[model samples]
Target: MLELRKINKSFGSRKIITDLDLQIEQGSILCIVGPSGGGKTTILRMLAGLESIDSGEVLLSGQPFDPTNLKEQEQVVGVVFQDFQLFPHLNVFENITLAPKLSLKQDKAVYTKNAEELAQRLGLANLLNHYPYQLSGGQKQRVAIARAMAMNPKVLAYDEPTSALDPGLSQQVADLILEMKQAGMTQIVVTHDLDFAKRIADQLYQVTPVE
Candidate 1:
């Protein structure tokens, strides 16, 4: 389980999240939806250990790690950016394996097998040698998903996954989220797309600004 208790965050003097609390069971999908600047992304950033938590705690299972320490949470969760941030110079296979190899220090053979399996599952098996520039928007998004899965993290978070896709593509993304859950991957999705959220979310969190 993942739990965020009374979490608070700020950027300089501007507070982003205050007194926020959330709980997500393993293998479930949770969608955080609200207007822009409601600190949705900040919540994900804190989960990914990319932002500092000002107060409260973030827990995985029953373990709490320092939110400011990337090393503490690096292997516990993975993130997929909205832009499908694949490396421009690396091919699909390379991009997917890079983090696992570098961050986790997994052997090349290990990450190679992992990447190939994720690519096949995500329908990118044939695009292994293709670079980001050659992929369509949907394909790029799939590649991003594959990249995140390669880390074998217990939880995955996506930022505005449907922002660049048409309705049909958005539905596909929702289907993939369900597939991930069936495969026992916990998910935290931050999006303004209500229809997409309704299609996949097992739990929906509406985040409003804290005064």
Candidate 2:
């Protein structure tokens, strides 16, 4: 399980999250919803080790997790940023396999095989050669998701998952999230879309900005 205990965060004089706690079990989906700038993305970043916590503890299973430890953190948490953060310089396949290729140091054929399977599952098999700019918003999101899944981490986090897509495409993303959870992947999502949160989340957290 992933748990945050009495977490506090501040940027300069402005506080974001204070005395906040969350828990997500393996194979469950946790969606966090709130108003804009309510620190939802900050929470996701802190969970992914992209941001530091001011105080409190982040634990994986029952052990403490150190945000300063990149190598250990990457082994457990994978994040899909709100903007879909795909590499502009690399094609889809390259983007998806980049981390695994570097970390696993396996033969090209091995990671390529795994990437192909993941792309097929995420409906991106046909777009392997396409660049991010060449694809639509929804396609880029799927590519981002595939890239994250390729890491095979214990936890997956998405920030504002449906913000950039049309309503139709947003539903597709919701379905994809549910499919991933049903396949036994733990997920943590931050979004303002309550309906989308209802569709996929096993647990939902409401966050209010600390005044």
State which candidate has the highest lDDT: 2
How do the residues 1-211 of candidate 2 rate in per-residue lDDT, one tens digit apiece? 9999999999999999989988899899999999987999998888877789999998988999776576732667788888998989999999999988888675799889999999899888899999999999999998998888887788989999888888788888888888988899999999998988998889999987666
Candidate 1 per-residue C-alpha lDDT over 155-191 given as tens digits, one digit per residue, 9 for 90 to 100: 9999999998876788788888899889999999999
Candidate 2 residue runs with Cα over 4 Å from true position: none
Query: How does model 2 fare in lDDT?
Result: 0.88
How far in Å is the alpha carbon of 156 misplaced in model 2? 0.8
Query: Each candidate: what lDDT?
Result: 0.87, 0.88
User: What lDDT is reached at residue 199 by model 2?
Assistant: 85
Structure candidate 2, residue pairs in collision? none
Per-candidate TM vs. native?
0.94, 0.95
Please estimate how well model 1 matches the true structure, expressed as its whole-model Cα lDDT. 0.87
